[model samples]
Target: MTAGVLSPRARPRLGFLGVGWIGRNRLEAVARSGQAELVAVSDPAEVAARAAAEAAGGCAVLPDLDALLEAGLDGLVVATPSAAHAEQAIRALRRGVAVFCQKPLARDAAEAARVVAAAREADRLLGVDLSYRFVRGVPELRRLVQAGELGRIYAVELAFHNAYGPDKPWFYDARLSGGGCVMDLAIHLVDLALWTLGFPAVRHVESRLFAGGAPARGRSGPVEDYAAATLTLDGGAAVRLACSWKLPAGQDCVIEAAFYGTGGGAALRNVGGSFFDFTVDRFRGTARERLAGPPDAWGGRAAVGWAAALAEGARFDPAVEGVVAVHEALDRIYGA
Candidate 1:
């Protein structure tokens, strides 16, 4: 949560390793931020690679990771499928290139640890676009909670229910996606809650996962379309999380988090089930105060922030360890 999304320091040369929609969108965000130079892009699909390159005002469109690394990039943005995130990020790091990857970081905690270890070994900057942290009201909530304004927070309720989920085939395959709604949507809730609460230790985790209206027996089996989990953090705080995809949710999405503490309570809720509009409210007795509201351009701030930090010569941030922590909690939720 800096003043500007992009750094004002020297612009770093960057490459996009996967130019699918998310990849291309982040590329455009960085390009628009003017914090980095787009050197090259590579994707297995020629259409996507070329489209992303064109979107960057015609950067070099290469064939693969090798060509991208050979472009002399100072940084790489990995937006491939979930299964590819860890390996691609590791390869980029080993090449001495900084990396900002899309979420899940890896399918599970072990894979995530490997990527983080690689980044530490290479002494490079590693970032993941967990995106929610950049949301306008979210950072403010984090500030309040960490500042002890929300004294002794005892409970957190978070949810993300998407009316229409991923349209990709890989998402339905647990091996490819890691998990369903939980992996795709609930991950944000988990990250936001932990990050806001300053990453407390999870004393225990319990959960129920369902896919196709049946229990998801194992992580390696069916992909969960609905999930509800409870995380008991140190200090006896209970974090409740629920997420689903293609549910009869009556709206586009339901994304919200409510925090209750001894001193006060606050909540961040979406407006009209719109993904982009959100409001944060503080509650004292029966009264409420608005902390933040819509018209905030936060969608791409995570990607932009990473690039900006790179321009400022940031390297090997220890905060990347939080990524590992998030995935570890995910593992426990899946009964690991």
Candidate 2:
């Protein structure tokens, strides 16, 4: 149902499907936005679920996804493990519930497509938390590229290196977490590159995967700790990406997305190795102009945006098509 046609309640009832740290953060964001009413929460861990319920001022602590679905929610916020994203989102959508999920959306393109199809059939809103696009300067950077202020963009560079890897066992398993650093960190890079350039067709992709500094040619074993890939877009712009976990970077993290064109250049870079702080700049010859910078509470924006849209009675957005396309490139990166 579209807005003003079958308007949702003034405050759409939402359910938290996973109450982990990321999940709770998004929950608070949506709640604080005053766009939706959180009515229920579900997680495998009772402690986490109870903690989130208390944080939400005593929303019902449900048992699982089924119970949450039964709580009459207009939307479901999914923050579960990577492998469970597709199944959980599809199930929720088919129940006529909107879904806001943490990305990869699914492990591969095929799974992502199925989830999107379910949303289409149900005519329900579907959103993925690809939060980097909400970073302060990213929108300005995108505007510069799309507006052709950067001229004919030629090469793009992306990188994300975490000095410390994941602390969870599931993250090390390719089967469970999809891939390692690429899935965890580079997904943002890919999303940023494609998004900044308006989701152009990916013409070609070349990749190198490594685990413990050794070549990792397949996903059958442990996930890669390091990955490098170059993608040729529809118009021949080259986008190169490198991301890793636990590398000796002498800092907490290193992240950047830089674009060079005939007329000028632009970039979004982390400041002081801080994941939460970023600065964007545009360059023309020897002169560089600042675009935007830090202290942005962007991590929860993707989810909160979806909540606001759902409360406005938005449904079945075709923009989700681009998210499925994102997986197509990710699959190619993994040789899937």
Candidate 3:
């Protein structure tokens, strides 16, 4: 069916699975947007579920995915652990429910492909919360590069380092969280690089992983606390990525993505160690011009876009294949 804008009374009913901080945040955003009706919430934690239900205008609190599915949901919002993402999304899709899920989408490329196939078979919408693309600076930078304002793009550098590690135990488990820094943080870098460069075929990938200041012994060993990788795009552009947790960087966080071309360069960087505030600039010779900056409410844009797309009757977009491409790159990085 051709997509069109939805009215309030015609909005799709949505159920939230895993009402953690991120989940609730997205729930609130979707709830406030009036694009979807939040009809149910599911979380193993009673307190979290209750909070989410209240935020969702007293929506039903169900016990699990099955119960939520039975509540007449038209879509599912998944904020569960990384390992469970693929299975949960596939189940929802098989039952004909659209899904907006947190990133990594799956533990690996094989799992990601299954989910994509299910969505295609079911003719349902599938979205991943790669929130970085929704940021204010990203699209503008993309415009410049695509317009050739950056000339022949030669090199790109991306990094994300967090002073504190995840408080959840699952984040440290290799099997559950996928990998450490690469999966959590560098995923954004890889996505931005490939996306802005128009999804060029990645020709080669070389990587080194480390855990607790030592080289990781094996895939099944400790999850890497630090990771660095280089990707050579088919068009000959070089992309480098690095990310870490508890790096003693003397800051709360460090995040940057810089692209260099033969004519000029452009960058998006966090301001003063603040994660929420950012600045984008273009460089020409020794001079620089600002493009965009702070006070950008970007965290919830991806979720909001998904809800709006669902409202518009979008189903099984061909762009979903990008998720598999990203997972394939991650697989090569982890040597899985």
Best by TM-score: 2
Instruction: List the candidates' TM-scores in order.
Output: 0.96, 0.97, 0.96
* Per-residue C-alpha lDDT of model 1 across residues 168-263, encoded as one tens digit per residue: 999998898888888899888899888888899999999999888898965868788899899999999999999999899899999999999998
Residue 229, model 3: Cα distance from true site in angstroms: 1.0
Candidate 3 per-residue lDDT over residues 1-336, each given as its tens digit: 212233434789899999898999899999889989899999999999998999889989999998988877888999999999999999999888889999989988899999999999988989999998888978999999999999999999999999997999999887898888888888888888888888888899999999998998435789998988898998899998889999999999999999999989999899999888999999998999998898898888999999998888787898888888888888888882
TM-score, cand. 3 vs. native: 0.96
**CA shift at 296, candidate 1, in angstroms?**
1.9
The whole-model C-alpha lDDT of candidate 1 against the native structure comes to 0.88
Candidate 1 collision pairs? 7-308
Per model, how many backbone clashes are there?
1, 0, 0
lDDT by residue for model 2 over 146-194, one digit each (tens)? 9999999999999999999988898888787887888899988998999
Candidate 3 clash figure, as a count: 0
Which candidate would rank higher by TM-score, 1 or 2?
A: 2
Which sequence of candidate numbers ranks them by lDDT, best first?
Answer: 2, 3, 1
RMSD to the true structure for each prediction, in A, is 3.8, 2.1, 2.7
Candidate 2 — which residues are off by over 4 angstroms?
A: 1-9
lDDT of each: 0.88, 0.89, 0.89
